[model samples]
Target: MDESFVDGVQGKPGSGLIGNRKFVISKKNLAAQNERGGEENIATGWHAIEFLLWGQDLSETGPGDRSFEDFVDGKAPNADRRRQYLTVVTELLVDDLAGLVKAWAPATKGNYRARFEQGGKESVRKILVGLGSLSRGELAGERLEVALNSQDQEDEHSCFSDNTHRDAVNNAKGIENVWLGRYVRADGSTLQGASLRELVAAKDAALAERGTRQIAASVAAAEAIQAPFDREIVGAKDAPGRQRIQKTIASLTQQSKDLVAAANAVGITKLTLVQP
Candidate 1:
């Protein structure tokens, strides 16, 4: 008598319980009986119908229930009649359910495919852009190295071996100005070109003076090296040997400073000495 129960099993195949042949329940009859029953009684019948449709026990019966025995013994309602009843009921409701499922399939499939394609395209674009940037960086580094080397060659050709003192001084100043210009441009600084050139020239002159002093000290060091060592060198008391070593080290240091200054005047920023 439960209409919803009939609706639930509307199109499902059934096991025969009423006869040897298949049968289906009437939806109108089920609905009419449900309307006539008391509310509590209708609920009980609905529960029983659900149990039967889902292959559950109608009562609190165990696996050894006599109802199952009686059903198998051919003493119950015809199996075919029960089966046909369930089948017809299911047939009536399944069309609406199937239509609902069909309506959702296209949208779900379309959205999934769209997302998959979008993700794939984005991944490819990211890889291409990264490779492009890396290529550009390598090209920029090579260009910078070539520019620095070219600048060095031009300085050597134009500024080396001038006869007049004025020409030599002007050329050294020009070289210093060029170095400063490059530095300021590289650093994105806002210094005026004229001022930068003057400042760089002054710095170069000071460095040159220091280099001359270092060269003089180096000549002294060479002479000291050639001198013969005494068997017993005399010194003042109270760690005189340590004091003498310290004074010698200081003289050698002054010579190093003068050498560094001389190198700077010629725009030689680095020096490597190979000792034999």
Candidate 2:
């Protein structure tokens, strides 16, 4: 989900979705929404949970740090409501993830995974589409460039947690992982197998190698970005932090182009992103 947009009820009019800071912080608001079969606008997933825990990022140097007392009765306003809201939102998030798991379950008949497994060239096309879309439009453009151009601290992705640096690193690595068909398990083990990299190599070795190098460069560039991302986006246009972000953006843009070239080398004619 987009982090900046206001997801639910606005306290006042004329407040833009991305600029609205008046989130419904009252727990009672959750109850009312739940009874109404849930709110269509309540931002769900990562940012929603982060807001419930951290409140807001009022500072440029650090993330929101809501006190634990905020969740305790007699310590803060609407403590009970906050706890209930967290519980409900977390449960809903889990349920939604479960649905995704079912859709991609390897053995499920007529599920997305089943179709994907048999899709062959079309499936490869889908993978390329995903990598290019995420690298180019989603990360480099929408997420990074948008915030940098606006120079608004609140415009940074994961602003509430100041985790946008990590977001950039992990997202770039994720694209690399898909390309290499490699995963480093939590137990410090590595899984390597035949992948898009190998397939592309068989068709066009130089293109495959170029894609690998570009993806690795992007990951390295992303890792160089400093944390407290809100701080990073607010300085002079040529500031060190902003330059680091710009380099990552440039690398991801190049990586996305490499993905398209890789796709073409493998006989896929067109690559397209999922419609927003």
Candidate 3:
């Protein structure tokens, strides 16, 4: 599914950007080929969907220049096939999310829910471990640091749509949700419960408040970067582009430290900020 096809089928209104058939590669098709003892490049997932929807970001001025006629009937070759592929991937994504929702439900018959329900202290530890690890390692290190260091557009989380800024902010929000013990669903409903913030507040109210403020600061810093992240990492260290990246990194690093302190305040004595 080419970016143009995605835009077209989604009713964005435009013609296909490039008429090449090579971009229609489907992961389901690739899996079938693999099962048949054949090798096919597997490049399908959220990023692939983004690529199909936004194509490649070939300019600093904007996102991929894909048009929308690729999925209109009789407008482009294999338009129907492109539509079918998009439908398949979209359905699969929804199904996967449903599975996660089921697993995380309070009454879920799974280890994930069971472990959290075992005890309040156990739950707190699990939550802080996840929060600390995500802030110090995955979100800060892998997502932000790796992309900034490499200065590669392909390394951008949503390079095609130039939406990595959203990724960073949302990631911070996720951390905040765990701390506050709340999550909003797609239908505008929220799941609320005891959270790390509540736990830490009981032990040390000031620390909990600090953690909350730090999380907000990090989110604000990330959202303040004016350019797409890929473009922000394109110059010398002291350049304005790199300066924006550094500011966000500094904010995340401080928040990570605050998260670690919050964990400690809640009695996680051996909690390590850096995880393998």
Candidate 4:
């Protein structure tokens, strides 16, 4: 039930086939699923749902094409099981997000959100640490370098949908949103708060501007790359696509360094750029 099922939906296009839908997820539930804690919880999260939705990127021309009927009342083997799994997983996702919404809702008290909002410097340090760690280790080293070194499509972050490029762009956007202290909520409302950008600028405006530019450059580098990072690495021996990916990696690395500087500006002097 991995990616090979892509062949089943190749010719079909929306006859209860080959389309995508949205699902809300609970972060805590997601973490538990990923951790599994040496238990029976199979790795279930966005990628798990993505696999069930898109199947796999078996096609060189485009993304996966999973059929909705695979999970509906049908003659297909395991149809009932598939339908039940999808329903339960999606319900879990919705329940998780409901918890988040309650935690972060305006005027909410004594939850994670209140603690984050109240502890100013601690929250800022946490944000910088996350941004720096993600850029330096997860995105730059693990995700990009491993794929580049092996030229393996399976290393892609969104391999099922061939959407790793979008993932990179969106990650950079998230970094930007944190620095700018602005983000659009799931309900179409805007949320603003104390930002790292303002915090840095209070001490050194040039450093702040440099960090902003580095973030933008990282995103631009990601966007400039051609589609399907897993496929693009195949051309590393001849084509220029590899160079584009390399450029994006460099951009991410620099942005990560900038994040460390920003963290230092905020008095968190013990930060380290982890690599894994």
Candidate 5:
């Protein structure tokens, strides 16, 4: 999904600096293409919605400033198409998510959830792999390090909305939730139970404690990076914002190592993760 968004923005930026398809691609061409949701090199998905909502991020200290009037038919170019595209793409996203929910539903008799519950060690390994991938390869590397190294505002994730800071915070929070086996519902309720932390603690209590602390440190550092992640990656090498981001990156890196240790503690010897 992210790859498709990148291809669209960087390659076929059609009508606007953000975009409005070059030409509408049919659903037939999109089949068998998971995450690669495009034909004729068009962009769709989260970034497309973001582009429509907030054009290009031309400002130095803020995000794109697309006006609501743009969606008011006849007030802006491609207003009708914009509305139609939004509806279609949003529905597709929701549909895809719904499928995932059903697959993971606890009550499902023979879905992925059932298979996973019986997977045991393999399931635990998969969980650690996913956490490792997200923490190091995705969040720390592609999202943070890329922008930090480039110092280009466009490199920032969710650049259209200046929400990269929140992205990092939320991602770190997700890792924490999984480690602690806790989830907070939209209704302000939280669910907690046995988790990766407990599993690691069973073998090595000190390692579990270290992993928890490191995860918390990463969350704190990510939260401290401030809004407008573009700004945080710019200025002098020792700038406060830059330093904050660096700290977050460092914390995330260390936590990835801690996660590897946690995995090993749980008897998963084959710990393989992509370099961030």
Candidate 6:
């Protein structure tokens, strides 16, 4: 018998039994035998196991020294075992594209789940052959959308509820955008750090002052209209005209109150109006 063949079965002394029943060596096997005890590193945790059985890893952990067994035994703390397992699982799934589709048809309910789903078994087989045992996250995301739609069928009523719509709107509104403009000096040069929060606050305060000035302008406009009518009615000394002035005063008061209410709704308070 060839020495290499004999040595392959009965590994060197401390390495453990080479040709024992527990140890099987064949030309087809690429991985080392565990019984021979040369590191026993077959990558056997969830990822390795998934790869061995399914021939793929679902998680995209990438090529590394860690094994599937390391994940199961908790020896590989740094490795992302979940990704590895998924990578292998996806790969294996791609192998029997037709079989997998038929098996998953009940869950998919005839709707296309992904690009692969559209192509059916042939597409899946091509993917498996091309990518081998790698799980593509982008493809997985697309696949998940199909799964989610199928799942939504089971809870149809809650799927399009008012609360869900409201939550989505509220979440969208939570995003805030703020712009910072450069502060310029008297000579037209920009100042460093001049657009900080304190400066912005001061600028906002100035805007509030301008808003109050608008209120003053509104009061002036109202008074201008009332003054001419008051003068006409006073000159005529008519009771009916005096009643009209009183109604006008009330209307102006209500308008002022409404303006205040509008300001409060937008979080704009503490206005200081300059008296004429």
Cα RMSD, each candidate: 40.9, 5.3, 6.1, 6.4, 3.7, 31.1
Candidate 1 stretches with Cα past 4 Å from truth are 1-24, 27-50, 53-74, 107-276
By TM-score: ranked, best first: 5, 2, 4, 3, 1, 6
Candidate with the greatest TM-score versus the true structure: 5
Model 3: how far residue 266 lies from native, Å: 2.0
Candidate 2 structure quality by residue, lDDT tens digits, 157-218: 78778888999899999999999999999998999977999999999999999999999999
Candidate 3 residue 202 C-alpha distance from true site, Å: 2.4
Q: What shift in Å separates residue 27 of candidate 4 from its native position after superposition?
A: 15
Candidate 6 lDDT for residue 247: 37
Clashes of each: 27, 1, 3, 1, 0, 22
Model 1 lDDT tens row, 1-276 = 232332222343333222323323465544454435454223123233333454321222121122333224365444444445545445535654565566545546555334444575343333223322222222112211222233322111111111112322232233334323432345687554433223324667665444344334433332332111110012333334323323333443453444334444435454442111
Q: If both were scored by TM-score, which would come out higher, candidate 2 or candidate 4?
A: 2
Alpha carbon deviation, residue 7, candidate 5 (Å): 13
**Tens digits of per-residue lDDT for model 5, 73-145:** 8886566666666666667767778999999999779999999999999999999988888888888998999
- Residues 134-187 of candidate 6 have per-residue lDDT tens digits of 111211122112222333221111121112222222221111000122344679
Residue 59 shift from truth in candidate 5, angstroms: 0.6
* Tens-digit per-residue lDDT, 104-223, candidate 4: 886768888888889977777778889998897988887777787787787777777888888888887888898889898899999998788998999889999999999989889888
Clash pairs detected, candidate 3: 1-24, 15-69, 16-69
How much is 6 displaced in model 1, in angstroms? 8.4
Instruction: Please say which candidate is ahead in lDDT: 3 or 4.
Output: 4
Deviating ranges (above 4 Å) for candidate 5: 1-22, 25-42
Better of 2 and 4 by lDDT: 2
**Selected candidate, larger TM-score, 1 vs 5:** 5
Error of 2 at 237 (Å): 2.3
* Local error of candidate 2 at residue 236 (angstroms): 2.1
Winning candidate number (lDDT): 5
